[model samples]
Target: MKNNTHHKTIRSFVTIFVIFSSLLLFSAQQTHATPIDPQYIFVRKDGSSCNPSDCSQFWSFNNPDKINQAAIDDVLNKIGTRGNNNNTRKIGIGVLIHYNRHNLNNILASIDKLLPLATENQIPLFIVLDGFQYLNKAPELWNWWDQDQPGYDLKNRSNVEWTCSNGSSCATKTAWRNWASEISLAFPHPNLASPTFIQANKNKLNTMLPKISSWYQSLPQDKKWLLGGISLGLEVNIGGNYYHYSNGINPNAPNPGPGNSQSDQLGYAAIQFLGLEGGITSANLDKVVQNYYTELNKYAYQLGIPRQKIFDHVNSPGFTLPNHIITTPESSLSPYGNPAWSFYNGDAANPQQFDTLHTIFQQQGYIEWGAAEWRAPNTTYSSWYQAFQNNFNFGNTRFINISNWERIRSEPEILKAIKTIANEEPTCWVTKPQINITTDKKSVSFKINPGNNNQKTRLHISSSSEYRENGLLQNIDIVNVPLNPNSTYSKPNLSDGQYYWNIVTTGCTNQRRITAGTFKIASQSLPGDLNGDGSVNIFDYNILVAGFGTKYDIFDYNNLITNYGQ
Candidate 1:
């Protein structure tokens, strides 16, 4: 009996030891697993001075001295050595240049002023070409493609008034191609071949590709890496209000036909430029846009800009064609025999938009993708954090350029979010929890997963008032509530207001916290509270009378009468 008891004790001790060893191994793995980090490109709009209030119009080509060195230093100091450990998250700068007649000089001067700073910091510099305004402002350039003759009325040609002066012409296909040709030549590569469109206009255009090529070849070998890439244009799109005037148009115009509006006129112009034999149908317009970008992309590639470095910056994913056909920039440029760069603007409120874009780029076999321009509402730090998180969750996001310099300098929360991303620690949650509010606004629930390892974690929730002030959460309502892997937790009777929540996890050596996002509880609406001031009094009655039949009706009046004081 003694021998059997001793054997049982030994087996139990061995089992517990094995379990403890396994947990220690799991914790070590979780601690070392690196999270995804994306490169951040801060856009210096118009090469302006760094002062948040400084509105100097010192064009880099004309006055490179006005470009503040302090601004560059400030940005670099804030971003810090986070990139030193991970190359993927390296910080870079984007300079927005509005091309003019002296574009070559502008490019050279801008490079001379900025490249040294970039090289010293060992970061990349991107040239963002913004020439749309110049296209309209310069008649000499505009006339080269679409000349406005003495008697020609552009309004008559498109049935809507254009922003161009009475006799000035709107952009034509030739204008776009010529602009592309000029940019290509100004930033030339050795293996470049003139596109067929450029070949057609060879007699009219001049060759600066050789000189540009020489300038690039003359750069010191160490400085060559500073030229990260060039954006062909900023938010390349068919001329909207930029080219056409938008007043005096009927709002209730008929659909599926060209109407007397700026959009309709732009569509009419697009049809002519694309050489399509049809009216301004959505299908026709989609074809026009796709063809324009495809050709523009080809111009850059033909000029020997590496397919990886060339980015087509379209605002939306793509235009929807008839029969629910969807087209993205990736899809349009992929069939031209090479994988094109997939870059877009991140202005969408829906998270699924990012997911859809990421999926499209992957399906199209695009290896490089990013947001060349991303902006968040200036209201809340949560919005900014969510924006960064959304972009970071997608692994292929190579770089994201925060739109303007002023936003960075002015918005403290923007810098905070950027710093948080730079210093993010690995978390134990394999799938992070996201709070979902009930339809009745009475409760909130979330699900979490710690994978097979079942790492230790705690969840917390707090009202927005006590959450995220100066980078710390105060007055947390639910403190360190233990969470189980793959289990759902519900907190009932949540009051009618915004709530913030997060998950805290402890690894073997460090602790990590992650925001699970926010939830809002909106109480049921009171009857007859037209102005939503929590009561139906004389003010509500006054509002009803003021809005009369347009905004409020007899039903509203009756409701107010029934629930007058309460």
Candidate 2:
């Protein structure tokens, strides 16, 4: 999405900046006016790899106790109850789809169990197609390197399976295309296709895209959007691409060979193998990447998916895309040294590097990016969450692996922060609303143009001069009001003093609120009403007579003269 396109004018951008600033100053974890849509938190047991070095399946498949409907409900209930108070649903599971059939079937079964509950709570599910139905470790694909294939120069051909349709290298693109054709719409998986069969049929990607989209369209309308989208390949950077040759970087050559300067390397080489002449030069790498995207875009279009819907998964520390969603999987802060933390370390004081990279992506016209598998360095899960909140903008989508659900459950602060961020409804770029205020001495009122007439609206009045999310300030009163631009709320029984107030309007999936507006209630007393009665007459005269001879009587005499007739 274009920056200038989303914010039509400078004023709109300034307004958002101001609102964001106010939120920073006053709201620590207050109820937000807006809630996030498709709020996802990864569930372990179902998503975590079974092994450390390489995970081919989820633990849930082998151990049912690890993930169940009850566990899923617990997460949604805990994290989806803030902004919109959608406890029944809203929290989504983030799981991985691998080349294994049983693992795929097991996940689908979990989704089936989850569907009913999800429907009630508006939850959407996420899937990471780990390696697209091709297991690089399977013996046929792994140990059996095709010595006959002319240009197969890379070590362990099975280690890198994403290559073009050349007879020699068995890792062909057709495997993905065929798997795409085999999966069902509701919860897609190839029809009992064994890993070996998929590995052997790795040459049919051309037929896959269209079939995948057709299945998508065939699903029930309610279920259609549940498949949020798939990240093309899991963390496309380091799957095995870090291999370096003698002069550095080149794993494949025109003929089969052994070590040192292998011809075609991993990712960058795959593109050239698909039919590009120039090779992977620093000058041509970017172009190669773009052309690679262009090719993927064609398949995505065939699948009836939009460019924005296809998230680009990056495993590198620094990745900038001119216009695409860059999703980081297993991302962490630098000191964690997990090797997943990209360009910026999790340093609070020196965040400029990450900011700089983010700026570059934005300048290239990208609107948003996020971490798919994120955790902080050496902190409790809750602190890890807080670190993420402190470091990144919550305006973009975020996710946490559910395998840590136990930690989240144990840490109240982390759970609270997660819910706060998750419940903030996301506004589409075009429909975001702004607030304006009007005030008088006794009352404060606000208006949201393009008002949410059908949804609930809240007006909060506080004696404090600024807004506070915690509502710890004295004399804070909140009231439910009609969601109309013309509607005004009056402060009741205000003790003739200044007051500050704000209004928040909530819609089905979006919300907007205004900053505090100041107003004062004037003291109500007539000049001659000395006795405090409504009128001035004998009551005032008698007081004057009682004190006629003293200094107090002098003041009484002044009052008597001033209101003698009244």
Candidate 3:
């Protein structure tokens, strides 16, 4: 949906671009934080975490059999006995929605794949459905059909046929709010489960999450289940623009649009083709589904979703519930976007005005998961963009193309880079530049202004001469400044350079430049004044004549600028 404007000043920290890139470069030499179990997040003590490419999903998977047993014992031990370990019971819950019989099997399969994650995390699940009434009731059985707008509320449709045998007639449709109370028993597929028999013609996840939130709250602290929004719910993050995520570089572009809600994200995450009734395939469908799971695991840490509860859902005795399947296109990118949630006045029906999905999902404790497209050049990675919005006052959701676990796998150098730059600190990182010798062949001497207020830090070092345009750099200069705990940045030496060298300092409270190597040098080299190249002879004169009165770029800097005075 379209959004207006809002702002927040989050304590900015080291942009992980360098760290992520480092992971890619040194995948071999770096100490990878392997998956502890399923998708657990690994933090390498701030600066200590040198490798990024090895960052698999969230927690690593360890043979499902072993994982399951461990989870069961852990759950029993924690539940039966108690100690200082207060917040260990959590689980990774996966929830998927289905409409009519179409794509029911795929939904089931998604849930099936979710078990290993659940076991590893140690949590139970509570999957709910808003529009997908038929599939949720049965939990196992499903019917299918081709194209037929079963209408918002499935009432009368061929494939969606219902049965009035077990409960009431097709006329008496049960609402989501009421159905939520009936726990422990799965509803059987009805005769007129189709559109005609449907009564509640409404499907708004925003109107549903709050209602379902109680189910999670009612459980014991340890048994509480976390929420997961599959395709539609997850896709909400991949908003309107495609960004190239590297070193937190803001790729300037036109506003693509605001993100979607959980249900809306799920729809957007889908891939479709308008072939004979939309050329959608199982792979496209699975691709969309997997995006949801992998992303859910990646950002699960931010969701406030308890870790242990998720484990129980996968490893628990009742873990083997029937699954929902998929066999359609609309499941991914929503061939037809849901009218319930959108950027256009937050109303899909209008398609004119817009509001960000964050306005909706952020209302509760739910945070959207940012997933990968498997294929490259994917424009919809949401987590980075969503977080970026907090940094820039642009729109509610700023589009950011950041790396995920998958990128971590592929990029080896990112880890190696971090290793080269980092020294371990158990709690947080202490990244400082290593300037060897400046272009002037002298030590770096610059201004000092620690960015953080009251956060004192040691200050030293000067800016070296700009890189030699004609020759390679000889020695680098780095002044070691012993910074205090919370100091901001130490200043860099200033010069007559026009580029201003972007004024980099040590101990920056904001941009920590953890894995960033090579400091920015002021390129104010005077044409004929080669710093120490002897005399302004043919060598220095040629340098000046080559680059005349140009300001900064005229790296013709040397020890011969006095010739003009002569």
Candidate 4:
């Protein structure tokens, strides 16, 4: 009986030991694990590829009853909301409301139908309030302004030509500023309009913004979060390459200049609109464009929308503006100091655009930014995969809206890329560590604080044999050294060079690699420079004498005596 009891106790101890060992192994694996694939909130614009006739019927502005529910559902289903792949990933639905005076009721009715579906499916609604889409569809909106300027129809054209009653040449600087200001203000707050301005003529047409804000406010508290964000305008820009004439322009159009193309017409119109006597330039154009978005974002903020939720779409590659320039597409349209939405359709293999964007973000200390629209240059699977991978590797890309849902859905490669992104775990920096020393005289000691407790953390140290190539650290030397938070890790024998360190924390769902920044070790230590103050002097001798017995030995004193001064 005694032998049997002893055997039972030994078995229990062995089992407990095995379980404890397994738990330790699991914890270690989680701490050092490579982050999973990135996941994104994939959004598709509704009725984007429909024919004009189909769109008119499907998105009926005059008659809400005529709006086809079945067609809308079919599109939504295919986007993976209520389809066969309902469990695939979170899909957002975008609704574009072409603002006009007579369509408020119709717009509301359409939203009423779509909002419930989005809410039911737990999908986000990307509401795009497009002011330009109605330019050709509702010519009457521009009739009051068109009366003074005949032959210059602001219809189906990307550029807006605002001429005075005295002709295109009569616009003064003050007049241009006033006109631009009034238009910019009126775009957001249509009711508060200057009676003298041309924008006032379409006051009723621009009321859609406030009306939509009210509609959004009136929703149940639970459903309000479903409204992803409201875009003030789509791809808002000052007449750049994007602002080409919808119907090809005649190269021989007179008055603006001789041998003028559509681009020249845009430049001329921009000059008149901005009152820039020096013609089209990035600085002048950026100011006007910035103000437009600033006012729009301001009004949206007043309506209780958070800064992060409001977006203005622009296609400009993110560039750091000069000091004199207060705003650009990158700065002004940024929801909160980071461009929330920009289009990317460049070659995936050579993603130099993102490189520039990454540098700007790093320099400005902005946390999150996203590609509002991204598409592969080609239909090949490799092209799509490379494009998605490039964006993913940059690490801050929070959103990527496929430009054309119909086209993307048809291509197996594009769909595969989307699926791959959806399945991947999103890697993000949680809290960057604050290092003790930025530059060391000789050896390096890193006192790292990851700034979070109760989380599994590890330290990653890397040295680049060659200095950074294209803003990326090369040749990683050390990685995944287990570390306790807020602890000191000293490399007392490191040679003179720049070294990078980061903290990797394993969270509940995602693994965060927090960059602790780079430190440089300059070998300026003399044999007797115990104080490490560049030159071996009385200070070095004092340090050596102070720690004679407890810290320093006879060798240290000998070194100090040998190279005391010269």
> What are the lDDT figures for the candidates, one per model?
0.46, 0.40, 0.26, 0.47
**Tens digit of lDDT per residue, candidate 1, span 382-493?**
7677777776555334456766665575567877667666556322213223222222336666656453222566777888423221112456765448777667778877
**Tens digit of per-residue lDDT, candidate 2, span 296-358:** 443554456433334444444554332222223222111101111222224421223355445
What RMSD value applies to candidate 2? 23.3
Can you give the lDDT of residue 268 in candidate 2?
37
User: Candidate 1, residue 97: CA error in Å?
Assistant: 1.3
Task: Rate residue 206 of model 3 by lDDT.
Answer: 33
Best candidate according to TM-score: 4
- Alpha-carbon RMSD, each predicted model: 26.2, 23.3, 26.0, 18.8
Show pairs that collide, candidate 1. Answer: none
Enumerate clash totals for all models, in the order shown. 0, 28, 140, 4
Off by over 4 Å in 1: 1-38, 47-62, 81-84, 101-107, 143-225, 239-243, 246-263, 294-296, 318-351, 354-359, 378-382, 423-566
Residue by residue across 1-566, what tens digits does model 3's lDDT show? 12221111111112222443454455423222221111111111111122454321222111112222332343223223211121211222223343332243443343344444443555443332323333443322221221242223332222221221211132122211111132211222222222222222122323333333444444332232233222223122111111112111222323221211111111111332111223233444334433332333223312332222111001101111122122222122211111111111112112122233333223311111112111122223343232222212211110111222233333434323222212211122122232222233122333332322223333333234222111111122444454443234333443433221222222223212111113333343443444432223333343444454564232333233335322
Residue runs of model 3 more than 4 Å from their true location after superposition: 1-120, 123-219, 222-566
Q: Flag the better candidate by TM-score, 2 or 4.
A: 4
lDDT of 4 by residue, 1-566 (tens): 99998677557545644654575566445434332112245545544245554353244445556544554464454443321132222345555666543456666676666655555665566676655423433443333333454333433121333322232342211111111121111111111111222243235324555555665666554344456566665555544323222222323333221111222223344445446556545665555555455555555655555444555566546423232122244433332222545554453333446555556555534334555555557677777666777765564444556665544544667666555555554344243343454233556555555532216666667884221211222445754467655676666666666676654444423323333345565555678776454566554555655686789865665576578674
Please give each candidate's TM-score: 0.49, 0.44, 0.21, 0.52
